[model samples]
Every structure is written in structure tokens, then in C-alpha cells.
Target: MFERYLAALEYPSQGGINIDDPKEFRNIVLWLEDQKIRHYTIEDRANLRKTGSATDWDPAYAKYKIDLGFPANLKSKTEELTWLFLYAIKLEYSDNADRYRSITAAQKIEQEKKSSAAPEIKSTNPFDKLDFTSPDFEEGSRKLAEKLGIAYHPDHLVSLRAASYVISTALNKEVLKEPIITGKPFPIDEGIGMGFENHQDLEKAARILRLLQIQNLRKLQTAINETIVAVQNITADPRTDTSLGKVGMK
Candidate 1:
């Protein structure tokens, strides 16, 4: 029934339809709300070994809230509907539905779980080996010296290297703290201390990295969408391909 509604919305196409039309969007939202309420009521009653009825399901409705552990109860039908609507919109707007779905689903689950995990911090000594010629090595040393208002030395350089490693590790750990679809940490390469030859080169590198990251995210979304489609037995229509191209889905 959910998939049928999604199909009615003509999802899986680029910019498939404008949900900005308040009346129509609201109608769709209401329909989704009804569906969710009915589904939840049925599931809850079955779990409790009770004869499920509208009145009997009232107690099952609860506000969604994040706790230290366990998924939150669904707060309201509106929230569930909103999520479904946004998901469909995202899928239609972005070519990479799979990645979006995976990330979104993981986030939703994490929100419910109220994850208490903290990032792991790693520290290292930088001065054991010296490679001052490399921009990354030199820049790290220079930044540390400037920040500390101290003269540069081999020992200082080593300390700076260690600091850089620590900072990079902390950042990566934070990213990993987020729940992932695979329930495994993402593989991050060794931290490269920032040391570009010039500002232009730095800007270019940043831009390239951003683009690559976006593409990677898109790929992930696409994979997730494919998985969902397969599980739901949704087949890709040839018309969807043409429609996607028309809306610049690439």
C-alpha cells in the first residue's frame, strides 16, 4: 500500500512532481498519516496479542523522543508522514536515492536509539622522523610554532606533527560516530596535514574534494535505493530513465 502510494506520486524521476502545491501535498500527507496509523495499530495489537481496534490502538500512540537506548515511539502520524514525503522528494530530486535512503534510515534509527558512543582520540609523537621539505610537514610545524609563539625546532616539529595527527583522528572519529548502514566504521585514509604550495592550490584541492565527496554520497544513495527497490519488487521503468534525464538527474 505504501509502495502503491509512492508509485502514484510518480517517484523515481528527476524533479518528478512539485509537492509545493500545499493542498495536494497536504492531501498526500494525510493519506500517508492514515496508512501509518493503521499499520502501527495493527502491528502493536498483534505484538500484544490483542484484538486490534481503533479505540484499542489509542494507548499505543506515543511521542517520539530520543533516549539513551532504544528507538523512540512514533510521536504522531504527521511526523511519520513527513519523513516519507521528504524521502520521496529527495529520491526524485537526487540521482542517488540509495545513499540518501541509507544515510537517512541510519540517522532515523540512531535518533531513536539515542546513541551514547563517544569518539576515540588517538595521540602520537611527531618528531621521531623529520620530513620538513614536504608542505604538510612544514605547514603543520609552522602553524604550531605560530600558535604557540615559539621558535621552530626539530622537537617542536615533532610535537606539531603529533598534534596534527591527533586533530585529524578526532575529526574522523566524529564522522564515524554517526550510525552507518553497514554498522561498520568508514575507512578513512591517513590524515594529511594541510600544506598546499599556494592559496589557489588549496582552494582547488578543497573544491575537488567537495565534489568527490558529493559524488560518493550520491553513489551511496543510489545503492541504497536499489536495495529498497529490489526488496519491494519495484522495477525501473524505461520511461523513468527518460524522465530522469529530462530533469537533469545525472
Candidate 2:
């Protein structure tokens, strides 16, 4: 189902496409229109029109998510399938999906085996080596921070300092907006709190924000999966087998 779209994406005539390029963007738009005629059945003119205020890819997706319990009709099943194909193709062609496919099945199995046999490795934080706590580094940091125009409070966390440097670099490259940092004397989190602010180039800021959001979402999903397994293990009896086949020691 995703083959056609994925093929076009992975093997464009240019070998790759710059979406920012006008020719490339127009080519993709034409390809999608052509695909509709050749492969799928998106006959609805309203669906094809992007000028509308109400409906588009994101809106339709949100609608489908909320109306999940609604039964599909025999007549519109074809249309639904076409939409599904489009959604699946887009998802499968994304960076997230590419990352998911990075490891082969054999590599995964080998990794699992190694993980089971090897000693547990403590996760290392990248900020650990960025020791901004030292007094000697403070003066140099101040001078650099002043040059860059990014907010750099001496009391800020090392993690935050590193982030500031990254933002500063982005600001220097883009030269679009100043990086702003808002801090408060919170009761927790080392008594200083920080968060994302709308204080940089919109596109770049959105990209980084989305990346962080995706990371948090992945962590939340992992926590939920682990919690489910832990609950089942604790509650399930080893001697019995249910429709699920087995649980706990069983």
C-alpha cells in the first residue's frame, strides 16, 4: 500500500528532493495528483481542495481519531482505505519510521541476547561532562554569552547552559531572532525552573520543540508498557493459563 509513495520519496528523479525548492515541491504535488488517478480513488472534490478552512490532512486525522468507535460503511470503505493508505505511506516515509527500521531483525535479537547476558550499563547524561559549576569556567562563559547575546545566568543549571549555547548557535546562523530564557525561583527542580519559550526562529524552534515532544511521548509510552507488564506479573498466577496463553512465571 505504501510502496508507490515510499518509492517516489526514496528515489526521486533528483535522487532526493529539497522540499524547500519550488520545482521539487511542484513535482511532488503533481506526483500526488497523478497517483490519485493511477492508484487510489479519491474522487471527492472537497477532499482534494486544500483552500477550505475546515478540512485537510491534520483535521481529517483528528476527526478519525475521535470517531474511532463509529462503524465503517460498505459504500465509503474504499474511500476510507484510500485515506488510510495515504496516512500509512506518509508515516512510513518519515524520520521516525526510518529510525524504527534502523536495526535489522537479527541485530535486534543479538542486541536482546547481549542485553540479557551483559551487566547493566548506567545511562550517561550528556550534560555530566559540561561542568559549568567550576568557578574558572564562569568568566569565559560570561564573555562568550555576552558576545552571543543569549541569556546566561551564572546560577543556571549546566544542562540549561548547554541548551543556551545551542540556541545561541542557531540564532547566530539564522540571525532572525534573539534567544530568550525565562527562569523562576521554583520550589523544586533545584529551586530554578526553565521551559521552552517562543523565543527563536519559528521554524527551527518548532523543529526542536517537536523533537523534545516526541522524546517525552516515547518515554511516556515506554513507562506505560513497563507498568502494564509489571502489573500483569504481580497480579497473574503462574500455575494458570488464560486466553492470553500465560502470565508471570508461566
Candidate 3:
């Protein structure tokens, strides 16, 4: 079924369709949605819990996990790369939503505060509002440091440097096509434990992480947009440069 879907999108033989093509991409998205619905119908029945049962009928959430793996499989394919492409757009939307909520919350807080201190800057840019206290940021930073053979410290300058490197790399590859390096393992330290040093540190860390997430998301959107433009140029005329140099040079 997945192969048939890819064939409909003209994968491989036609150098595959661009993820930015709204009409074509929407078809692919709808197909995915339909598949997900079908999968949920089957999985839900298999895992349905009894009214008074202490244990789930299907252990380990196998049904949902199996269904989720289909998307992951699509993401792993090189020839059928639309999954990651579409996934990036979804992430960009989520990040935008988060940024909006954060801004709204900040505005409310500012309005409630009666202190004489000057008003704080409220940036819509996601990177500017990263919160390092977030588990994602801390975990990502620690894992990255460990991978790079650097020691991980929660509040240390080195940890921040490591996080910046990790965040930059992820953004460059997953978000921006101008990746500094390719085929590198994501910097994540699974061994690092999670706990807050203090309330101040936690707040500061969360802010930093939020900023990084937003920046990364923005980069992804930009890269996707560039891909769309390149595809449009090619569709207009086949003589256009389709080489990696042209596509990558931007």
C-alpha cells in the first residue's frame, strides 16, 4: 500500500515530487491520514481494555507502536522521502503555534505585573525564547556533549556551548539544507539524569531551549520553502540545473 502511494506520487523514476507542492502534497497527506484512521480502527479493537481490568489487553501498546512505525519507516526511505518533508512542515506549524501561545502568555504576565521595571522584550522568534529548563533541551544538550566527548554540566558554560552546537547541527540538517556536516549522529546524551538545580536555573534553561526550538523550526520552514521554489523552477523548464550543486548552493 505504501509503495503504491509512492508510485502515485511519481517517486524514483521522476526524481520524486517536491514536498512543497501543495496540491500533490495534500494528496499524500490525505492518504497518510486515511491510513492512520484505518490503523487506529484495527489497533483500538485489539487493545481495548475491559471495564474493571487492572492490565491492558494488549501490553506495550503494540498496536499504536506498530501503527506509528509505518511513518518512521517512510521517513527512513531515501527514494520515498516525502514523509520527512511533510513531517518537517507539521513541526514548523507546531512551533509557530507554541510561539503564539508563549507570546500571549508573556503579554498577560506583563499586563498583570505592576512593578516599575521596564517592559521586557517579547520576541516572536522561537529561538529568542528558549527555556533551558525543558527536559528536551537538557537531554539534547547532555547527549550532544557526550557524543562529542565533552563533559556535561547542567548550568555550566560548557553545557551551553554544547547545546548551541547540538541545536545548530539539528537545525542545519533537519531545518536548513546548508548543513555544516552531513551523516553525523545527533548529539544526545541519554545517560544524563533530569533534575533542576534551582528555580532560577530551571527558568533560564527553559528559555534557552525554547529559543533553540524556534530557531530550528524556522530554519526547517525556510529549507522547505527553498525546495518548493527549486521544484517550481524545474517544472517550468526542464533545462534548469538539477544538480546537487545548484539545489544546495541556494
Q: Find the candidate with the highest TM-score and give its number.
A: 2
Q: Encode model 1's per-residue lDDT on 1-250: one tens digit a residue.
A: 3444465445343433345453444445334334432333544334223223334332332221111121355465445454665554544546555645566657856864675566666657664465767878677777876765555556656767666665675447786797755665533322443455367567556656866797899999999999998845533444444533442246
Model 3 segments more than 4 A misplaced: 1-198, 238-250
Which residue window of length 10 is worst by lDDT in model 3? Answer: 45-54
**Better-scoring candidate (TM-score), 1 or 2:** 2
RMSD of each: 28.0, 29.9, 32.5
Task: Rate residue 54 of model 1 by lDDT.
Answer: 30
lDDT of each: 0.51, 0.53, 0.53
Which one is best on lDDT?
A: 3
Q: Which 10 successive residues of model 2 have the least lDDT summed?
A: 187-196
Provide the lowest-lDDT 10-residue window in model 1: 61-70
Clashes (N, CA, C under 3 Å) per candidate? 12, 0, 24
Name the better of 2 and 3 by lDDT. Answer: 3
Candidate 2 residue pairs that clash: none
